[model samples]
Target: MEYNLEVINLTKNYQDFHLQQINIKLPKGKIIGLIGENGSGKTTTIKSILNLMTYDKGNIKIFGKDSRNLTKQEREKIGVVLDDSFFSPILNVNDINKLMKDFYSNWNEKFYYETIKKFKIPDNKPLKEFSSGMKMKIKVLCAIAHEPKLLILDEPTNGLDPIFRYEIVELFNNFVSNGENSILMTTHITSDLEHLADEVIFINDGNIILDVLKDKIDSEYGIVELLENNFNNIKKEDYLKCLKYKNEWYILVNPKYEFQKKYPKLKVRKPNLEELMLLLVKGE
Candidate 1:
């Protein structure tokens, strides 16, 4: 099977933090969610893939070719949306369209206009005058209008309202339905990934701690609730993590053994991605 993006033993070192040996593969036509806490090296890993940051080790391949050796045509097939704005603050939507047209050989003016209209952005307004949400939409429009095969997004949903976020998520879903494109988006919003991501990659302290299919997570990890008093009898080692509330305790467990049968009174239930991530990151 072909892959849209692949990272092999990728490592980057900073003065105070190190992004340890990282390996990830993004299959073609799938939306892979890269979830991590702040300063977890998500951005660093993305920069390494884009060749925007210098890394000490590992190989990055895009479209089955080494990223380092990518020609201009190969580079044009990837669209990137980082946390920082790429367009000039003084430039209007119209100006941005014209500028990007010069950069991407496959830039589709018709698609650009349609995206702008769909997002309800005014072509004449200066980008600085637009709200954060509008600015993000403009970035999205610019990135997608070029008809890139892969999109690398860093916190693309950060400033949007809930309604817009949902709309954007659906847009991404539709975008990948064609099975010729893919996206690798890094976000802290686990809820977004729960619905849209086929695969999930969790990064912590500059290292990948969990990488699995979302469906597997749903089938493997479960939440077990017990009375506060009974919590003391539940072994901590048996659970991935646990939490205590005022009157009850909730634990995340991988119930592959007969342990649940032994503790018949434990209330077992399913957990969403948010709960799983909280447990995994907390190590509680």
Candidate 2:
């Protein structure tokens, strides 16, 4: 399958932190969830892909062309929404519309206006007057109005209520329906990824720990709740991670290994992405 974006052995080092040997691919028309804890290098990886930060090694390709080689015209096909607001605090929505119109060659005034109205963002209200959720909506609107082929979003759901978060997830679903658009969303909210992500890349401490299809994860990893007494019998090497809550111990095991047969009394169940991520990151 052709990829919209690919990162090959990417590495970036900072004074105190480093993004080491990161490899990721964003397949065309798919929404990839980049799951990681804070300071896990998600933003650093995104910046390296966009060439916003210099990497010590490796290559990033967008549309099969090296990202570093892409000219302004080529780069325009990608849209980005970071954690912070890029628009000036003093600028109102009207000012932003005019500013972006001059910035992007393919900027669509009609779409921008329609989105602002659909999101209920007041055209005359200054950015500083808008709530965090409203500002995030504006950022999303600006990114989509230009009709970019690939979008890179960093914590787009931050500060959003549950209702609006669902709305944003639906918006992303609609965006990728065009069949030419792809999204790489880095977010801590794993619940948002349950229904939306086709693929998930787990990052921890600047390194990718797991990269797998969402469906495969659901089918493979089982959460086995064993009695405290039985925990000592379970082989620690066989499980990916384990946690103990009071008298019961919850273990994440590969279902292919026949964990149920070995521990018949253990309550084996499927785990969601969030639980799996917590286990991977916290070693529990």
Candidate 3:
């Protein structure tokens, strides 16, 4: 199947940070979660793909067209929610709706009004008067109102309450159910992705460390908690990451079958996204 988005050899350089040869692909009809620590190049990668920043070396394609040379029509197929509100704070929800209708030819005024109502956004209140959570909801509302085929979300759920967050996640699930739409989101809430993501990409300090389907990760890797004495006994090559507390060891390993079979005395459990990320990001 053709990919909805593809990035090959994506590289960027800054005074103190570098986004090295990052490569990623998002297939149609899938929600891929991008996870990284603060300043790990998630925003940089998104900006590069959005043509907001120039990269030194790489090719980014969306809808099989070069990202850098997208036509107006091609650009319309994407919906973006960045870290901050891109519009003027003086604009109210109604004003935003009017502006977007003028900008995106496909904008659905009906849907926009309904969504704002559903999200409990006050039409007359200026964006500057809204709380952070309210601002985030407006951004999300604006992004989906045009019915784009692809969504590029950066910290999409920041400042959202749990109730709204859950609702948005459910909306995302429905968005891709038709098998034509796709989403690339970077969120700190790994728990949300643990439930909604089809695949997870882990990036660290500019390098792509792991990119795998959620199912494959669960089936292929397992976390083993080992006592100090048992840590040296397991085969080291099996370990993808290992961390030590006071005396216990948290080991993330591949070929889980072999490790589990060999060490019947230890318990092996599937690690959630957060646990896996912690091991990869914090462990040695």
lDDT of each candidate versus the true structure:
0.86, 0.87, 0.91
Candidate 2 wrongly placed segments (more than 4 Å): none
Q: Write the per-residue lDDT of candidate 3 for residues 12-106, one digit (tens) a residue.
A: 99999989999989999999999999899999999999999999999999999899889998899899999864799999988888889999999
- In terms of lDDT, the poorest run of 10 residues in model 2 is 255-264
Score residue 89 of candidate 1 by CA lDDT: 89
Which candidate tops TM-score?
A: 3
Clashing residue pairs found in predicted model 3: none
lDDT of 1 by residue, 60-151 (tens): 99999999999999889888888885777899988888899899999999988988888889989898899998999888777788888999
Which pairs clash (backbone N, Cα, C closer than 3 Å) in model 2?
Answer: none
Could you say which candidate leads in lDDT?
A: 3
TM-score of each: 0.95, 0.95, 0.96
Model 3, which residues run further than 4 Å from truth? none
Worst 10 residues of 3 by lDDT: 232-241
lDDT of 2 by residue, 1-284 (tens): 98999999998888999888998888888999999998999999988888887899999999999999998887888988999648888899889888998999999999989888888889887899999999999888888888889999998888888998999999999999978789999999889999899999999989999998888888888887778777888888778899876787778888634877777766778888888887787765
Task: Flag the better candidate by lDDT, 2 or 3.
Answer: 3
Which segments of candidate 1 are over 4 A away from where they belong?
Answer: 245-247, 255-262
